[model samples]
Target: MKVYDDKHIKNVVFVGAHNSGKTTLAETMLFEAGLINRRGTVENKNTVSDHHEIEHERGTSVFATPLHTEWRNYKINIIDTPGLDDYVGEIISSIRVADTIAVVVNAQNGVEVGTEIIWNYIDTYHKPTLFVVNQIDHMNASWEDSIKSIKSLVGNNMVLVQYPLKIDGAQCIIDVLKMKCYKFGKDGGKPEKLEIPEDQKELADHLHNELVEKAAENDEELMELYFDKGTLNENEMRQGIRAGMLNHDLFPVFCVSALMDMGSGRLMGFIDNVAPAAADLRPEQTVEGDILVRESNAPTALFVFKTLYQPSLGQITFFKVKSGEVNLNDKLVNSRNGETEVLNQLFIMDGKKREPVSKLEVGDIGATLKLKHTETNDTLHEEGKKITIKPIKYPQSRTRKAVNAVNQKDEEKLNDALRKIHSQDPTVEMEFSNELKQLIIGCQGELHLATIDWTLKNIYGVEAEFKEPKIAYRETIQRSSTANYRHKKQSGGAGQFGEVHMKIEPWYEGIPEPEGFNIRGKEEVDLPWGGKLVFYNCIVGGVIDARYLPSIKKGILEVMEEGPLTGSYIRDVRVMVYDGKMHSVDSNDISFKIAGAHAFKEAFLNAKPKLLEPIEELTVKVPEEMVGNVMTDLQSRRSVIQGIDSEDHFQILRCSVPQAELAGYSTNLRSLTQGKGTFVSAFSSFQAVPRNVQETLVSSN
Candidate 1:
């Protein structure tokens, strides 16, 4: 194996919807590069990128797999990303480091909801993008229709760089710029170029003319030259097209059948000549404060994007050096913690394999093993360098499931393993309910949780049972009421006697804050740190001791942890210890604790208490034909339609729906749209459940 120099590097990410042939295309690229002796299939569990046991068994990618190849003096670092929405976090990590994103679209399926998702992220980041239409050999595949869908989903500026030459329905592409036609034989045999078919010259000419027009539009000089001469030379046209692609003025589309290993060689030319190199694309880095640092001379600064926990190999954190050079055993300080650690060794990763390198230059992506303080999203820089790099913002995980160790003995191991996993992947989070005695694991979706389960057993040597997570609900008061409780126990030499007279009312709405409350005429009730908590002294003639006031307020706070209606904690309620009696000798924290518990129950029951459930803002992307069905489904789930927008033959619907109503929403939406629609959800705010539904929740809890 040979390592290409830094100047020839090209970092590209392969992304798309599940079953869109991203992994297959990655395998094909590796095979064409001669890095692999045989092609691996997803169904037979022998793919190069999907090497993990879990991914192989499931026949899908769960993590981003990085591979390297030398094509035309270029070191192409290919990152194969999972196409499923459940592992979207993995895709995000891959895209963050990529200089260019290649969105793989299925020929038969055209544009899917997931494809639109990847497209939106790519556009948001303003990264240079390419559209690769894969599986063209599939029956009923239409290249023209697929290109039309791509243009509609993307923009009309998308140009076909390669033309598919169909021979007996086995699709093979012709490099339009090269002016050569090729055909594929049986069972992944080597491709052979043939003379251009007589009937296809006009069709090829049409695509070629369109591409040339786009190339001319990219350069004013070239456009004027074309106007004067009526044509552009081959070299001038290629230069124009490359410039247009780098500026994002045009997205060059390529057609290929990865299963047959066709059109990959021609695709390499586009990658080497047209794809932007890191140095070409990376903006100059500068200090935020007094000092300034350029990419050419700045001390080494690497941003860790992804981390993996291998039981046998410890922790491996992958990073991209934004500036300077990182050498072996170099000491770097973590900006977040200000702790220095030795770099040890830098390794350029290829799938699960690593090739150790002496040093990594600026704009190079590599990984280091067994770093103590470094984690994902952390920045490693020179010592005393108080600088921070921006982190890639990943979409928050919306789906959650409760898990427990299947074998009682593995409970502690499961907890420790999950924590390790979370440390490795920030996208996976865990929530524990002490009262409910359940460990809820939050992920991208159901498949994500399933993959975690499989990994836990296969890789971590721990087994767990997973169930749907229960909604985290809260109880709050609706009406106002007053109650009093007396605690008088005479069991020992010193007795306890205390009483609490307090009123409970619903907290003032419209953003719960300190200034939202005014104690009418009381001057001492204004506290800055206290939110929605008001203490009033309404005693007529010192019925309660002023010295014991703080104790009474503390007792009220302790009782607020639980409401009468449910075990969930109460929030935004103002409690006033207006008047209470306390025995100076016996009344202490313990006595007040008992009185507080009783008084809270009475007041809470008197005041009508209700349950509140968390609501989430949802954005569903679906084909235009399924908009009505999705809207109807949203309404059925008690969702409030905030707005809707149509773009590129798809409708994006935004709404706020209760989290409880969205537990199985992914599955339901798939069924509703027949696997053509999906959505991303975000936490909005906690809102009160309807009075009629509160009973059902409370009883279930």
Candidate 2:
């Protein structure tokens, strides 16, 4: 491997829906470029990208892999990404370091849910994008309908660059601009010029004309020449098309059978000629964050988009050098952690293999073996130089489950494994609640969490069990009440006497208020009950001692924690010690504590206690075909649909759904749409459960 300067490097990412041949296309590209002697098939579990044991067993990609190659004097750094929704975090992380994205779609399936998702990612980053209609050799493949679907789902800027040439009952492509047809399976299809097939000439001309028109539309002079003469020179069209693609005004779609190695070389050539480099695709910023530098003359700064945990190599950090140069043994500071580390070696990574490099210049993707403190989303830069590039935003987790070590002895081991995986992936969130006695793990979907569980057991040697997480429930009062309690205990040597009168009631849910009502349009009374406990000296005649007030409040909190009904934590209640009596000699803090505890418990029992359950503001994004089915399903869970909005080609349905009812919503949503529908839910607020539902829960308990 060789390090290319910013001007000669191209970082490309392969992205698309699940089972869209992204991994196969990447393997084909690597093989055709001679990076790999023999092409590997994913079905055989021999591919370079999906090398994890879990991935091989599941026959899907779980992480992103980097593969490097040289094409026409250009260094192409390719990132093969996972297509499943659960593994989309890998796709996003890969896109962060890419200058261009190749969205591969299955010809038979046309556009899918993942197609729209990856396209949105490309759009978000404003990167140059290309479309490859893969699996053309499969039966029921429709190139025409796929193009229309791409155009409709994406925009009209999707132009056909080359039309497939069906010659001698074999699948191949005709270079429309080159005016030559190439047939496959003959002499191994060395890309020799041949007469254009009669059946493809008409489609080729129409597609070529459309491509030329779109290219011309991007340039005034080209548009003038095209309108006057009905055609433009090859060079003129080339320049125009390049500009259109860079400006995101056009995305050229090409057909290919990646399994047969057809159109792979042509696709690489198109990328080399049309794809923009890092300096050209992304606006460079000065180390001072002043002027945007189009050329690479500034200080060194690289963004760490991903962190890979290799069993033998330890932690490998992957980053794209945005500006200047980074050399072996160079000391770089992590801007995020403010820790400095010396790079002992630099390598261009290919799956599990590494090609050592002397230095990685600007616009190149490189790796460093294990940094002290730097992790994903961290910036590595020269000391005293600050450069902050925007980090990619990942979608919120869609699935959550409680995890526990299969054996209590493996508890610490489970936590250790979780931390490592979480550090590598920003989308997987791991939390623990001492109250629930469960370790909560949230991820993109059920498959994602399951994959993590498998990895924890296999790679890290820790077995774990998973279950639906328990919602954090709380108890509060609904009405106001008052009670008085007196504690009198006499012994042979000493005596204890104390009395407390307090009121208990509901306050504003979020705001602290008085027991009965919150006074408005008036300044808050300087009552002693402001901070958790108030002792109103309405005892003007020295009824109770002001010295023992703190003890009473402390005792009140102790009783509040142990609610009378279900032993759940209580909130939104105010206690006021209006009046009390205490024996001067025996009424110490202990005596006051006992009196307060009994008084608060009496008042709470008299008040109307109710259970509060958490609700989430759920926004479901699904295709229009599943909207009705999803709506009806949500209704059964006691969800209230707030409204509906449009999200590009999908529907965004918003509703307030209870957390209890959404225990397995992720799995259910997938079943409803046959793995096409997905959603995100966030904590909205706590709402009281219906009486009937509460009765059922209470009885079951």
Candidate 3:
């Protein structure tokens, strides 16, 4: 493998909805570049990009696969990303490292729900993009309708660079910019270039003029040149188009039938000659707020964008040379943790196969094996010169499930497998909820959790069961009350004698000291679990020794840890140990602890304890037609609608819903909207449960 300079490297990511032909397009491009002997279709489950076992079994991309093809003295690194929302982590990581995005649209469906979702990420990254209308040769393909939908769904900046033409029931592409016709044979390889047919010449000329104008508008000099000469040559047009794309002023559209390999070769040619290179992209800022330029002569720095576990090869770390060149045996320090790893071997990844390379240049993507501490989002730089790149921010998990190992002995294995999965895919989180006493796995959707389960059962040899996760509720006092308890027992040797009189009150911010009370010593401490605990020692004449106060507080904390109302943790409560009695020989730490715990529990019941349930802020996006039904369902779940915003054909509903009511909302929403709805939620605040619900919860407890 040969190393290419930054200027000759183009990092393009393929993004689209599921079954939109992104993987197929990538395979076709590789075949046209002579990198592959023949193109493999998704049906045969032999495509280079979707090479993962799970992907092959499901016939869909589950991971972001990196491959490269050489065209016109340029190396184009293609990052083929999954389209399902479940694997958005893969798409986001790919977009973070890509200079340009090629958003593939299905001709029959145009922009789909998945496409719209991915487009939001593309916009977030501010990546220059182009649209490819794929599968144009399908019997039910509608190029005109698809283009119209694209214009409406996307922006008006979309300009057609090529259009599909049919001659004798055979599909061909007419390149408007070059004013040439490419007619492919039945095999759809190595298209025959010829003059535009007489019938399509007029239409091609009009589109050619439109493309020229769109390109020229990006630069003053180009606009002047176009005005002076009434037209621009191919080279001049490409320069303008590249400038417009880099500035995000234009999104050129292309036509392709990836399944038939009809127009992919020309698309590859356009990318090689006109797409923006890594050097052309804006400089990235470092963690220290310094700009980092992409230059081979600069200090060596690499960003690990994705990590994967290969069955036989251990971990494969995918990274891009952000600055300078990295050669074999060069040791780099992980900027995140300061751990160093020597690059003994570097390889340019092509799907499952890797081609060994001695060096990787700046702006190039490659993978290294068995790095000690480097993981996704970590930066590798020169040991002495510490620098960190901005890490990619993934979306929070929207769905959760409680996972339990089938075999008690496999609990360790289950946790270890989950940790490994989280390391590779950070979007899937594993948390042990002390309040719920369940091991919960949170992910983007049902498919994501299902994949995790499958990986655990198949790869880790651990069978697990998944069910609705228990909600983490809280308990707190509603009013103030006082109680007295005495613990006295004579069991064989020394007797246990201790008495405690403590006042329990609900704690709040800006709470004043208790009125009509003589205060002695007050210490306020923040609980590790949340809320505050204010302990007051108002002992008169040392009725209880000062040393015993610590034991009393500890006992009170034990009761707080396991609330008297329910098993949930208590928060926002102040305990005042104003009066107590103790015997010198019998009132040990254990004795006072028991007395204090009993006293606090008695006062908690008298103070009107209440259950607090978690409330989450939900932002849901659904088709306009389904808004009424969705809102009704939310109302049934005890939700408070905040507001609604309309965009295109969709409505965005903002609501605050109780966490307990959202047990299986993901599955329900998908079913209600036929998988056209999506939502994201975050922790808002904890509110008291309703009276009826609280009664049921108390009874169940």
Judging by TM-score against the true structure, name the best candidate. Answer: 3
lDDT of 3 by residue, 1-701 (tens): 77799899999999999989999999999998899997898889988898888998888999999999999899999999999988999999999999999999999999887888898888888888999999898988999998997887667788999999888877889999899999888768778998999999889999999999998998899999999999999998999899889887789999998988888888988998898998899888999798897788889999999999876898899999998899999999999888889998899999999999999999999999999898899999987877899999999887888999999899999998988898899999898987678999889888888899889988889999999987778899899999999999999899999999989899999998887556788888898777788989877888889888888999988988888666888889888888888887888888898999999999999999999999999999999999999999999999999999998889999999999989889889988897789888988988999888989988998
Sorted on TM-score, best first, the list reads 3, 2, 1
Query: What does the lDDT come to for candidate 3?
Result: 0.90
Report the error of model 1 at residue 154, Å.
1.9
Candidate 2 structure lDDT? 0.80
lDDT agreement with native, every candidate? 0.78, 0.80, 0.90
User: Between prediction 1 and prediction 3, which has the larger TM-score?
Assistant: 3
Of 1 and 2, which scores higher on TM-score? Answer: 2
Q: In model 3, state the lDDT of residue 484.
A: 90
Tell me the RMSD of model 1 versus the true structure.
4.0
Better of 1 and 3 by lDDT: 3
Task: Give the Cα-based TM-score of candidate 3 against the true structure.
Answer: 0.97
| Better model by TM-score: candidate 2 vs candidate 3 | 3
Q: In model 2, what is the error at residue 573, expressed in angstroms?
A: 1.6
Shift in Å, residue 90, candidate 1: 1.6
Q: By lDDT, highest first, what's the ranking?
A: 3, 2, 1
Candidate 2 residues 1-701, lDDT tens each? 56678878889999988998988888888888888998789989998777877788989888899888799999889999988878888999998788888899999988887887677778877777889999777788888788888988767888878767566676667777666787788423346568777877787788778878988998899999998999987788877877787787888888888888888888898888777777677465544566544345677888889998878878999988877788899888887678898899899988888888888888889899978898888778888877765676888888888988889999999998888898889899888875566789889887888789888978889889988887666677778778888899989767888898877656652655443432221122232312132333334356777777778877777776656666656666766677789887778888889898999888887787787788999999888888999999999999999999996657999999989999778889989987767787888887898988777766665
Error of 3 at 438 (Å): 2.9
